[model samples]
Target: MPDSVSPPRTIIVTGGAGFIGSALVRHLVAHTAHEVVTLDKLTYAGDERALAEVAAHPRHHFERVDICDGEALRAAFVRREPDAVFHLAAESHVDRSIEAPAEFVQTNIAGTATLLDVIREWIDGPYAAARSDFRLVHVSTDEVYGSLPLESETRFDEGTAYDPHSPYAASKAASDHLVRAWAHTYGLPAILTHSTNNYGPWQYPEKLIPVVVLRALAGESIPVYGEGANVRDWMHVDDHVRALVAVLERGRLGRTYDIGARGELTNLSVVRDICWLLNELVPAGSGGSYERLITFVDDRPGHDLRYATDPGRAERELGWRAEIPWDEGLRATVQWFVDHRAWSVERLRRR
Candidate 1:
């Protein structure tokens, strides 16, 4: 919401074709005057359709480059001459990470190190004069804190200790440490942000909300894990993108900001709510409802019991706060899936 973002600077957004990355890209194109260069590897989860809204924008450019490629990253730096970088490229799905951890490690940890090295060279070489003004916001997750007891009311904050349980969390934690090291040792100007679960339009169908919505609409069994007791703090993708931009523009160097909307819902409750919304919006059949399709399944290995974060620092310092309430956000998200049911079904089939 700041006025200075309208000055037409080139910014690099890694993984801008993915869910959250695309959301950030759309936000930048719609709200700011900055030219966005989206660097993506076009992985299975990285769909160009997510960036459909800004695909034709003159200020938006897409590069099919993986973050793990140091040479490609260097080339991108030289080609774009970016003023800043927003690192969001990673293997994000926890379930997929459990099945294939090597991919997570390579993309999340190794790729991050490569980007840091490239940025260091940029600052020391071509961008040396503007090094003081350069910033890199490394987007991370709250899963790095591991799980909090379901009965506890406490939430993860900036000072939370790292206790990553799954491969995904561990990979992200390693990336966070590397960012901090680069900042301290090489004096790289960087900001780190940890956020809770994000749900909204254009999210891949493999995720929870989309899975539930698509399943219910298709009259298929909606799967819930482990009695659906795990809790997560949900933040709308729109709110998260706003917080990311705020951090990039106003946050202090070497600081980590936790972003969340305080929208907590258990897995079962979320599923049930979605079913209720679908039953009302799309309707299942005569004398039947979508709630009947709820099906519980075995819990995945190393599943976190609860995850939440206090966004006090982001709200206090960056002048950003989540504006969407849980019900309203959920309603909007469910409605989006319903309206785009064909896209949802196609994505689900591909997965």
Candidate 2:
């Protein structure tokens, strides 16, 4: 009941037009008594239509600004004076990162540094008195831990040593370090949450689950890289958004939390499941089976074999646990895409 007891004074969320970011904003506006300011540069991957539901709410405001712009970020901080910040902006595609790493470095590393510098000034200067209650939550990915061995029984915990394998993860790893340094050196109230792969509505088509679903529905070849045996721990977007709010409200500053649902599935199995669900939900396709569209392709460089998260610390310390089962959540997600085919088509066209 913290949302009822102590409403957030003002919360600023970056990358608020992206998939996970949009879901977080919708959840906050619908379920909490907090005012929200969404700052996004609306990159090609960031679609403003994802936030159509709450875009016009009185408590919700949108600002078109890039995080790397120190002046704009500083002005935003001064204008919003947010009690908490959820930093979710980053160039997050592994393949795209491999193709063009400079964008990732500039946005993920330099952009995060810019925000930290502005925050340090705000904490030491005008907002010095209100610094104690101010909290900044940096959203990161579990890919920074690299791949787990097939024989390994343990999951990636908050204490997992950094083993980033891709340009995307390396950039995020740098940002993580910057956040930690700012917290330790300047005593800024900051926390980091590294989460597992997320699957839900509003996801971009480049990701695995969405790619398969969209391709299957469109009767296009569904690409499966490297025999599709690579595994991932999936967490529904709702669960991740809940975990983020928990960290922002009750988590210890200077600490790192790993958020996940512990639902592990291989890429092939995931694609097959999505195909099965679509076959049942939408029966108009030829061959009556979506799996026929599967097409094997070369894997991306530095592709991890597996990823899983150990959320014991988050559960024990923050009293947070993922509530939805993968079966039910995945079904709901598939049905959402089926019901909103036009939206997805338009998104793909724009991309």
Candidate 3:
């Protein structure tokens, strides 16, 4: 809401077709004057349909290029000459990472390194004149902090130490370290943000909330891990993109910000909330609620007990706050999947 993003700037948004990335792209197109070039490899989790809203916009563009392809990355950087880059490309699922840690390391770690090096060389060689104003906003996950005690009052802050337990988290942590190293050693202008679980429309069905909504509609048993007591802090994707925009504009170089909405709940509670919401929106079975489909399964290997983060630093410094309330956002998300059930179900089937 600060009058326009002021003085239009061209930006490159990596992974712009994925859930959070698409939302950010849409937000930029609709709310700001910045010209956006979406750079995505269109992985299994990415879908161009998510960008339908902005597909024809005059300021919107798309390039099907992989970050790991260094020459292609270099070409794209030279072609776009972007003033800013929001790096959101990564292999981001914990279960998928567990099943194939190599893919995660390759995409999340190697891909990040390739992109960082391209940007570094761009700044040092061809784009040095624009270096003073260029910014690279690297979006990352809070899972990199590992787990916290379920009943504890502690929350990860900006200064929290790295303790990644899963392949996905470890890969992101490594990428974070690389970014810092580039900043320190190569004088890259960059900032990093660690955010909690993000949920909203267009998320891949494999995620918790989408899985619950999609599977319940298919009459499949909804699975929860262990007693379903594991907790997570949820942040609506819209609010997240807004935070990303704020950080791109106002964040300090070489700083890390912890982003969370403070909407903490047990896994079981999130499942139940979705079930009851479905009961109201599109009652699944004979009058009985969808909760009947809930079945607790064995917990994931090395699963963290709980995950939460304190966003005090982001709020205090950026003058940004999560606008959507948790319950309202969750309910809206359930309805969105239900409303788009055909698309959701098809995506799940293919997955």
Candidate 4:
């Protein structure tokens, strides 16, 4: 680890109550000196209880506002006078995007535009005179690169051309472009990071890993789309959070970095692994094992076959790399959800 500086004195983290956002908030409060202001609309995907660990901290503040609300975002920006921003708010589910692309466009695109506009104005109007070092770190996904071929050895780099396959990825691609434009056109310092699939504690159960874990624990059929050959590079949320903080502190403005574990596993393999672990940890019924619950389901519309990322730039430039091994991370994640079953059940009931 590099020498640590005193944490950011004041930072704004949009979507700070969500899975990865909450992890980042916990990290900042527990490990650093940053006074964090979490601005979240508290969408179903976001739960304030996730941040209960640091909710009582005098330095931690929460604002209930949507990024799409331009006037509200502007007011928050002015009031907070944030020295840095970690923009993580978005409509992120690919399957949900297929059902309703409009929401994805509105939140990921329009909302990002609104936030950028506010940041641009804030930089030019008030903060310009001070000329302090500031950065806006925009968190995005590797899905914007579309799919990688099953046999391909190459991984997505920061230079990979945009080839979004789903509405969600397309919306994120649009937001990525807007962030870059704000940096280039208006000189607003910004950095973008595209990370592979993240698995860890506090994940919404709708996501694949969590869904599989929960359904298997309940003895429900675990759905596998298509042949379950879709491949995803999995990064633990903690590692990704660390990379995001690194980008905010050290990355060059207007540059994009890719953060991933390079631990690729097929969907079927991942499901089976989870089942096997569950069988050992929480034995199944007398008649069957958790793996027996696997059921093939129709593939999602426009499902990307594979996604992988090369984190070389992030490693070389930011001095960051994924530390947790995949199996260890997966085990920890499964144990977390198992231990927090009530939390997951309550969240699903709310949905």
Candidate 5:
């Protein structure tokens, strides 16, 4: 809603079937006049149901393609002839990356490089006429900046140095570097963004909020990694998508923006909050609380102590600020999981 009044144009959104990507696609189709071409591999996490609302829209198109498949990506590019690209496809889960670093390397790093190559070719060849107006938004995570001390008052800024601790973070860091390299070395009109933890409806159960909500509802022991003290800045998925659109439309090329809502909470505290909400919404029998099922598990290797970003840059440059309050968003998300129990259960089983 932050002044994205651009003319209707074909915009290619890679990984548009994933959680954040699907949200972005839905917002574009619902609000803007731009035509969207979604290119996704439809991995387990990438579900077409996420985009059900816009699936039948005339301006919305879906193409089954992986970012790593150069020939397939090239074909999509030539066929779509997009005026801009929003690259969101990647292997995103940290735990999965720890179990299988090779997959993360290939998808997050190599796949990004492949997409950058195609964008570069398009800017210089088939899309030469619109080269100056073309934009490539490379979405990334704040974990690439590594951890901040739990007590530190400082937040990650645009100038933060990369110190990725986990395989997923490292892979994204590599991709962020690739996007910048293409922009600087090849003169591509590209911008990068780093956002905080995102949670909302349609989120895969592998994430914290959904897992806590589902496990609590089923009366299962809620597993909390470590002391559940790791802190993260939470931004509602809606707020994050709005920021992304603002950045894509008005952000300066070759620059980076950090997006966050300043909703900081420790892992344990978040689970407790969800339990309380469930107890209030759907109380358990015998007047027992959901917190009784809390179980602390082994901490993940190299888990960051904290992650918070200073959204001052985005606020000033793009006139964007997160509008959703933490408590309100959490309640809404909890209710969403409760209402959509089937989807949550299926995702939990798949995980």
Candidate 6:
């Protein structure tokens, strides 16, 4: 394959103010030479400060729009006429999904379908003449494959069957299928990826690592579900962002890639590691150790036992790999949460 260089093109990133979406947006602005548009609903999960650096950059723009809002989505699509659209907007928190499965279905499933409808219309009408190489990168999660036994060595690959166990996973799975159907039925060009758990700076404290760090800092009990035996492969947000870039740049349309770092750890182990790290970073409290705050709670309903991903295809096809080691990434993440404890606390309070 020969490379034909083109002018710097504009791309749209849905949920661009979100944890992973903002990471991707920042990477695109700082590293790549393309114009970036962030389309987000600015929901409770969205934090504009996350993209403070790029928010006003000449190459970046922000759109306060919801994917499920057809008129707004269509209007943005028509105005931007983006060369690529990275769909990362969704209700991602599993607990929130459990509490409000309807919201998950609305945002993750119905929102995706609406997005696809807009994209399909654009591709067939305006986009056909605007650019010859338009792509849709549908970001997904490994949870869609459900769980593997904690004792098993199996990991989800591109071919893994969909066995989503939770409302969140089920919603994402439906969205993934919608993307595929749009590609096959309507001739939409799309690529999908299922990645492992991601952690890093600017992540909302609702997740495990941040929750542990924040709770421990507040001298509150760090709740651990069940025995915290659930296992997950944790990849740094930067690594996941890099993989998304590669997928958008070189991935074949209609192919699904599995992105992960091979950094698997039990939930309890992850919590304990965060506890120990916080102890090293923020030991100014009257407490002896942060681990003492650990509290076991009932397991979540429909919780999967484990999730891991095999990135063989991604590595072989796109030449991308996870660069952040767990130890280095974990320490940095814990340090970030400690440094920004006030911000994390505020987010929790607002929630």
Clashing pairs in 4: none
> RMSD in angstroms, all models?
1.3, 1.4, 1.1, 1.3, 1.1, 2.3
Model 5: per-residue lDDT, tens digit, 45-134? 888999999999999999999999999999999999999888889888899999999989999999999999999898899999889999
Local error of candidate 3 at residue 332 (angstroms): 1.2
Clash list (residue pairs), candidate 1 = none
Q: Comparing candidate 2 with candidate 3, which one achieves the higher TM-score?
A: 3
Give the lowest summed-lDDT range of ten residues in model 3. Answer: 1-10
Model 5: per-residue Cα lDDT at residue 202? 88
Q: Which residue ranges in model 2 land beyond 4 Å of their true spot?
A: 1-4, 284-286
Candidate 4 residue 14 C-alpha distance from true site, Å: 0.4
* TM-score between model 6 and native: 0.97
Q: Global lDDT of each model?
A: 0.92, 0.89, 0.92, 0.90, 0.91, 0.91
Candidate 4 least-lDDT 10 residues: 1-10
The regions of model 6 sitting more than 4 angstroms off are 1-7, 130-132, 284-286
Q: Estimate each model's TM-score.
A: 0.97, 0.97, 0.98, 0.97, 0.98, 0.97
Which prediction has more favorable lDDT, 3 or 6?
3
Candidate 6 residue lDDT tens string, 211-314: 88888887899899999999989999999999998888889988999999999899999998988887788883776988998899999888899898999999
Judge candidate 6 at residue 258 and give its lDDT. Answer: 97
Candidate 2 local distance difference test against the native: 0.89
By lDDT, the best candidate is 1
The sequence of per-residue lDDT tens digits that candidate 4 reaches over residues 214-292 is: 8988878999999999999999999999898888778988899999999899999999999988988888769467999
Q: Please, what are the lDDT tens digits per residue for candidate 1 over residues 22-43?
A: 9999989988989999999988
Candidate 1 residue runs with Cα over 4 Å from true position = 1-6
Per-candidate clashes, comma-separated: 0, 0, 0, 0, 0, 0
Cα deviation in Å at residue 37, candidate 4? 0.7
Model 4 local distance difference test score = 0.90
Better TM-score candidate (1, 5): 5
lDDT of 5 at 5: 93
